[model samples]
Target: MKRLFFQLLLVSDLNVKDKLFKSAIAIFIRLTYFVSDIAKEKAPQLAANFDKNDLKSVETVFKSGLPTPDEYAREKVKALASNFDHSELKHVEPQVKTNVAVIEEQ
Candidate 1:
Protein backbone atom coordinates (compact mmCIF):
# COMPACT_ATOMS: atom_id res chain seq x y z
CA MET A 1 0.00 0.00 0.00
CA LYS A 2 2.80 2.36 0.89
CA ARG A 3 4.58 1.62 -2.38
CA LEU A 4 1.41 2.23 -4.35
CA PHE A 5 0.88 5.56 -2.59
CA PHE A 6 4.48 6.51 -3.30
CA GLN A 7 4.06 5.60 -6.95
CA LEU A 8 0.93 7.69 -7.20
CA LEU A 9 2.66 10.64 -5.57
CA LEU A 10 5.43 10.39 -8.15
CA VAL A 11 3.08 10.08 -11.13
CA SER A 12 4.42 12.66 -13.62
CA ASP A 13 1.37 13.10 -15.84
CA LEU A 14 -0.85 14.06 -12.87
CA ASN A 15 1.00 17.38 -12.50
CA VAL A 16 1.13 16.90 -8.72
CA LYS A 17 4.48 18.63 -8.50
CA ASP A 18 3.22 21.64 -10.39
CA LYS A 19 0.23 21.87 -8.11
CA LEU A 20 2.51 21.45 -5.09
CA PHE A 21 4.89 24.13 -6.34
CA LYS A 22 2.06 26.60 -6.87
CA SER A 23 0.63 25.80 -3.45
CA ALA A 24 4.04 26.25 -1.82
CA ILE A 25 4.50 29.65 -3.49
CA ALA A 26 1.07 30.73 -2.32
CA ILE A 27 1.85 29.66 1.25
CA PHE A 28 5.22 31.39 1.14
CA ILE A 29 3.62 34.62 -0.05
CA ARG A 30 1.10 34.45 2.77
CA LEU A 31 3.83 33.80 5.33
CA THR A 32 5.91 36.67 3.96
CA TYR A 33 2.96 39.01 4.24
CA PHE A 34 2.29 37.88 7.78
CA VAL A 35 5.94 38.30 8.78
CA SER A 36 6.15 41.72 7.15
CA ASP A 37 3.12 42.88 9.03
CA ILE A 38 4.70 41.81 12.31
CA ALA A 39 7.99 43.40 11.36
CA LYS A 40 6.29 46.66 10.47
CA GLU A 41 4.70 46.76 13.87
CA LYS A 42 7.79 45.76 15.87
CA ALA A 43 10.57 47.28 13.78
CA PRO A 44 9.71 49.62 10.95
CA GLN A 45 13.37 50.25 10.07
CA LEU A 46 14.10 46.53 9.60
CA ALA A 47 10.96 45.94 7.59
CA ALA A 48 11.90 48.76 5.23
CA ASN A 49 15.04 46.86 4.21
CA PHE A 50 13.05 44.33 2.16
CA ASP A 51 12.82 45.62 -1.41
CA LYS A 52 10.61 44.08 -4.08
CA ASN A 53 13.20 44.46 -6.84
CA ASP A 54 15.89 42.84 -4.71
CA LEU A 55 13.66 39.84 -4.03
CA LYS A 56 12.60 39.63 -7.68
CA SER A 57 16.24 39.64 -8.78
CA VAL A 58 16.95 36.58 -6.62
CA GLU A 59 15.48 34.37 -9.38
CA THR A 60 18.44 35.31 -11.60
CA VAL A 61 20.77 33.38 -9.31
CA PHE A 62 19.20 30.06 -10.32
CA LYS A 63 20.81 28.56 -13.43
CA SER A 64 18.87 27.98 -16.65
CA GLY A 65 19.20 24.23 -16.16
CA LEU A 66 17.11 24.36 -13.02
CA PRO A 67 14.18 21.99 -13.60
CA THR A 68 10.81 22.83 -12.16
CA PRO A 69 9.25 20.25 -9.85
CA ASP A 70 7.04 18.94 -12.65
CA GLU A 71 10.01 18.33 -14.92
CA TYR A 72 11.92 16.63 -12.15
CA ALA A 73 8.98 14.39 -11.32
CA ARG A 74 8.55 13.48 -15.00
CA GLU A 75 12.18 12.48 -15.26
CA LYS A 76 12.02 10.37 -12.13
CA VAL A 77 8.79 8.70 -13.20
CA LYS A 78 10.22 7.94 -16.61
CA ALA A 79 13.26 6.34 -15.04
CA LEU A 80 11.08 4.21 -12.77
CA ALA A 81 8.76 3.24 -15.60
CA SER A 82 11.71 2.17 -17.70
CA ASN A 83 12.66 -0.36 -15.03
CA PHE A 84 9.22 -1.96 -14.88
CA ASP A 85 10.21 -4.67 -17.42
CA HIS A 86 12.04 -6.47 -14.60
CA SER A 87 9.02 -6.33 -12.30
CA GLU A 88 5.60 -7.98 -12.57
CA LEU A 89 3.71 -4.73 -12.85
CA LYS A 90 2.58 -3.30 -16.16
CA HIS A 91 2.26 0.25 -17.37
CA VAL A 92 -1.26 1.40 -18.22
CA GLU A 93 -2.13 4.01 -20.82
CA PRO A 94 -4.04 7.04 -19.68
CA GLN A 95 -7.65 7.52 -20.81
CA VAL A 96 -9.32 10.72 -21.93
CA LYS A 97 -12.97 11.75 -21.84
CA THR A 98 -14.40 14.61 -23.89
CA ASN A 99 -17.86 14.71 -22.36
CA VAL A 100 -18.76 16.66 -19.25
CA ALA A 101 -21.57 16.04 -16.78
CA VAL A 102 -23.04 18.18 -14.01
CA ILE A 103 -25.52 17.14 -11.36
CA GLU A 104 -26.92 19.57 -8.85
CA GLU A 105 -27.97 18.49 -5.39
CA GLN A 106 -31.68 18.60 -4.70
Candidate 2:
Protein backbone atom coordinates (compact mmCIF):
# COMPACT_ATOMS: atom_id res chain seq x y z
CA MET A 1 0.00 0.00 0.00
CA LYS A 2 1.03 3.62 -0.39
CA ARG A 3 0.93 4.20 3.38
CA LEU A 4 3.16 1.19 4.04
CA PHE A 5 5.64 2.35 1.41
CA PHE A 6 5.80 5.83 2.95
CA GLN A 7 6.38 4.32 6.39
CA LEU A 8 9.11 2.12 4.96
CA LEU A 9 10.71 5.12 3.32
CA LEU A 10 10.74 6.98 6.63
CA VAL A 11 12.31 4.07 8.47
CA SER A 12 14.86 3.24 5.79
CA ASP A 13 16.00 6.86 5.48
CA LEU A 14 18.14 6.46 8.60
CA ASN A 15 20.32 3.48 9.49
CA VAL A 16 21.07 2.58 13.12
CA LYS A 17 24.24 4.66 13.27
CA ASP A 18 22.66 7.62 11.55
CA LYS A 19 19.51 7.33 13.66
CA LEU A 20 21.39 8.34 16.80
CA PHE A 21 23.07 11.20 14.96
CA LYS A 22 19.74 12.43 13.62
CA SER A 23 18.14 12.21 17.06
CA ALA A 24 20.95 14.21 18.62
CA ILE A 25 20.67 16.84 15.90
CA ALA A 26 16.91 17.06 16.46
CA ILE A 27 17.33 17.48 20.22
CA PHE A 28 19.95 20.19 19.70
CA ILE A 29 17.69 22.15 17.40
CA ARG A 30 14.79 21.92 19.87
CA LEU A 31 16.97 23.03 22.79
CA THR A 32 18.39 25.91 20.78
CA TYR A 33 14.90 27.20 20.05
CA PHE A 34 13.91 26.84 23.69
CA VAL A 35 16.97 28.74 24.87
CA SER A 36 16.43 31.46 22.28
CA ASP A 37 12.80 31.91 23.35
CA ILE A 38 13.69 32.05 27.06
CA ALA A 39 16.50 34.49 26.41
CA LYS A 40 14.14 36.68 24.45
CA GLU A 41 11.50 36.64 27.19
CA LYS A 42 13.77 37.14 30.20
CA ALA A 43 16.12 39.64 28.60
CA PRO A 44 13.86 41.53 26.28
CA GLN A 45 16.16 44.54 26.24
CA LEU A 46 19.12 42.44 25.21
CA ALA A 47 17.05 40.52 22.69
CA ALA A 48 15.72 43.73 21.19
CA ASN A 49 19.23 45.06 20.86
CA PHE A 50 20.49 41.98 19.05
CA ASP A 51 21.62 42.65 15.49
CA LYS A 52 22.27 40.02 12.81
CA ASN A 53 25.81 39.65 14.09
CA ASP A 54 24.53 39.17 17.61
CA LEU A 55 22.16 36.47 16.44
CA LYS A 56 24.97 34.66 14.68
CA SER A 57 27.07 34.90 17.84
CA VAL A 58 24.25 33.46 19.92
CA GLU A 59 23.76 30.62 17.45
CA THR A 60 27.45 29.81 17.55
CA VAL A 61 27.49 29.83 21.35
CA PHE A 62 24.39 27.66 21.54
CA LYS A 63 25.77 25.14 19.05
CA SER A 64 29.00 24.86 21.01
CA GLY A 65 27.75 23.88 24.51
CA LEU A 66 25.04 26.20 25.80
CA PRO A 67 22.46 25.05 28.31
CA THR A 68 18.85 24.65 27.27
CA PRO A 69 16.02 26.84 28.55
CA ASP A 70 14.94 24.28 31.15
CA GLU A 71 18.43 24.15 32.60
CA TYR A 72 18.72 27.94 32.53
CA ALA A 73 15.34 28.33 34.23
CA ARG A 74 16.34 25.99 37.06
CA GLU A 75 19.61 27.82 37.64
CA LYS A 76 17.95 31.21 37.48
CA VAL A 77 15.28 30.17 40.02
CA LYS A 78 17.85 28.80 42.43
CA ALA A 79 19.97 31.91 42.12
CA LEU A 80 17.00 34.18 42.72
CA ALA A 81 15.85 32.17 45.75
CA SER A 82 19.27 32.31 47.30
CA ASN A 83 19.91 36.00 46.69
CA PHE A 84 16.44 37.42 47.38
CA ASP A 85 14.08 37.27 50.32
CA HIS A 86 11.01 36.72 48.13
CA SER A 87 11.03 33.79 45.73
CA GLU A 88 8.58 33.14 42.95
CA LEU A 89 7.61 29.54 42.07
CA LYS A 90 4.28 30.43 40.65
CA HIS A 91 3.99 28.55 37.34
CA VAL A 92 3.99 24.83 38.21
CA GLU A 93 2.61 24.89 41.76
CA PRO A 94 -0.93 25.88 40.82
CA GLN A 95 -1.23 23.36 38.00
CA VAL A 96 0.09 20.53 40.19
CA LYS A 97 -2.23 21.41 43.08
CA THR A 98 -5.23 21.58 40.78
CA ASN A 99 -4.41 18.20 39.25
CA VAL A 100 -4.09 16.58 42.70
CA ALA A 101 -7.37 18.05 43.88
CA VAL A 102 -9.17 16.82 40.78
CA ILE A 103 -7.81 13.28 41.19
CA GLU A 104 -8.79 13.20 44.85
CA GLU A 105 -12.34 14.39 44.10
CA GLN A 106 -12.71 11.80 41.38
Cα-based RMSD of the predictions, in order? 26.7, 24.0
lDDT of 2 at 16: 45
Q: Report the lDDT of model 2 for residue 34.
A: 86
Task: Identify the leading candidate in terms of TM-score.
Answer: 1
Q: Taking the tens digit of each residue's C-alpha lDDT, what string does model 2 give over 5-105?
A: 44544664654457765566556656767887888788978767868987798889887797889999999999987896433457667888999999999
- Candidate closest to the true structure, highest lDDT: 2
Model 1 residue 103 distance off true place after TM-score fit, in angstroms: 43
Q: Model 1, 1-106: lDDT tens per residue?
A: 3454344545633665587765565566567678868877878765778688876567665655598899999999999988767433332212112122222322
lDDT per model vs. reference: 0.62, 0.72
| C-alpha TM-scores of all predictions | 0.29, 0.27
